[model samples]
Target: MELYQLRTFVAVARAGHLTRAAEGLHVSQPAVSAHIKALEDELGVALFTRSARGMGLTPQGQALLARAQSVLEQAEELTRAARSLRQQLDGELKIALNTDAEFLRVRELLSVLRAEHPALGVHLPQNMSHFIAEEVRAGSLDGGFVYGEAPPQGLEAVPLCSFRLVVIGPLAWRERLAGATWADLAREPWVWYSDALPCHASVQRWIAPYECRLSKVAVTDYEGTIRALVQSGAGLGIMREDEGARCEGAGEAFVWRGDSLPMNAYFLYRRDRESDPAMRAVLAALRAVWGLEQPLASAHMRA
Candidate 1:
């Protein structure tokens, strides 16, 4: 009956879970359920059937799905056409900044957006990749820079660049860490990152093959905190290329090459919202600055 309810129905059908649909819409699970229930009641038909695995569309629901999508697409096209006429961008976009925002040279993108869209309010918040991915999918934020092969389901991720994770420690440990095996590094106190971080997960997997018993002295998701800790001889940790190139080149920290993890970063945004004027503007700004390849239809999935 309502546009929001129709959108919720499509999201639920795509995700096959009430919780997942709620996340993509940035609403509570109960809210999603209510939307579906209201729609079904108004139309006098059952839309979805509950199962042990998840929600599934009934025969009538499947019959209605295509028409629903067409309606949504038509509405979106109307909005896009009208906005294209005025070209007045206005809205708040909250984006997630990963650990290496500086290294990624994101100032250029922000500068372009400021010069182009004076009415657009952009907020960049620092967070772990996993947390950022969830927020982007939940629509709390417009989009984000996330580290992983792909964005979460119901979102589209464009590959930004590739970087390798390398171990680094205080220069004082250079002599001690030379040729240090994974087992040796595991024994030492570590400047660990938030366990929820994608980098932390990757590092754990990379080291898992070594069968090392890892220990941590401090935990933080902020790169600055990790850098300071490692700089002050706290312990060793992983950093991507360009995390602290000057420090490593100056012998301030030991760059251990024994164990390394190859990784990629992506720009993640909700798929259905791509045609939004503000979102399109943001994507254009990123493309202008980063000059990445044409957006890929399928993103490789990774944690």
Candidate 2:
């Protein structure tokens, strides 16, 4: 009957769990349950079947899911239209920062947004690349910087830049790795990234042809941890090209001459909210900071 109830319904249907839907909505579980109960009573039908596994959409709920989503989209479009007519942009955006702020030029982006759209506020929360994409798709985050081949479904991504991942080891191993092949390197202990990271896939692909398994001494999600471990002679690790160069130049780590993995960075947001004023302002500022040309294209598809 109410928009919030419909929103909760759609979120619950997508997540198929009360706790997750509540987290996505930023509300308590009880509140979410009450909303669903109220909606079901008003509609005179059960929307979901409660079971030990999780909430499952009933037959009627499955049929009405699309209509609920359409209603939400229409409401959002109306709000966006109203804001577009305003002389100045004014809203807060929750954006995810998947990597170091310095590397992403977040300060430069904030400066541009402050000057151009002073009324708009931005919040940047540090997150992992995979999690950022998921959060953006869930509508919990307005947008984020993600590293992947392309944006996931229902999202639009603007190509920021392309970079490579380089393998590095402690300075003590410089001579050892100088002429080492993939098999030789596999023998050495590695400070590897966890599988949850996108970089892990890159590393896996790079080593697939060689058919060797790395002996991981330490597995981490933080780039800083990997750098420190490699510097301490703990193990060889993979890092972004620029960071590896810096470490090698400073004599803190030795870069391996083997092939590097290619990666692309993108700024992603929900495709449906492309015309929102706050989203538009943020996108414009990001483009300026990254030196990308004006006028963002349609959602990037996976190739």
Best by TM-score: 2
lDDT of 1 by residue, 1-303 (tens): 899999999999999999989999999999999999999999999999999899999999999999999999999999987886587788788888886666656788888888888778888888878988898878888888878644566677877788887888998998888988988888898988788887777777788888987788998888788888999999987777676566798767878868578888888888777889888888888777877645633364444
- Kindly report which residue stretches of model 1 are placed more than 4 angstroms away from their true locations once superposed: 1-85, 295-303
C-alpha positional error of residue 233 in candidate 2 after TM-score superposition, expressed in Å? 1.0
Give the whole-model CA lDDT for all candidates, comma-separated: 0.83, 0.89
Q: What TM-score does candidate 2 reach?
A: 0.69
* Model 1, TM vs. native: 0.67
Worst window of 10 by summed lDDT in candidate 2: 294-303
lDDT of 1 at 116: 82
* TM-score of each candidate structure, all chains considered together: 0.67, 0.69
Per-residue C-alpha lDDT of model 2 across residues 72-123, encoded as one tens digit per residue: 9999998986785575877789999888898899999999988877888899
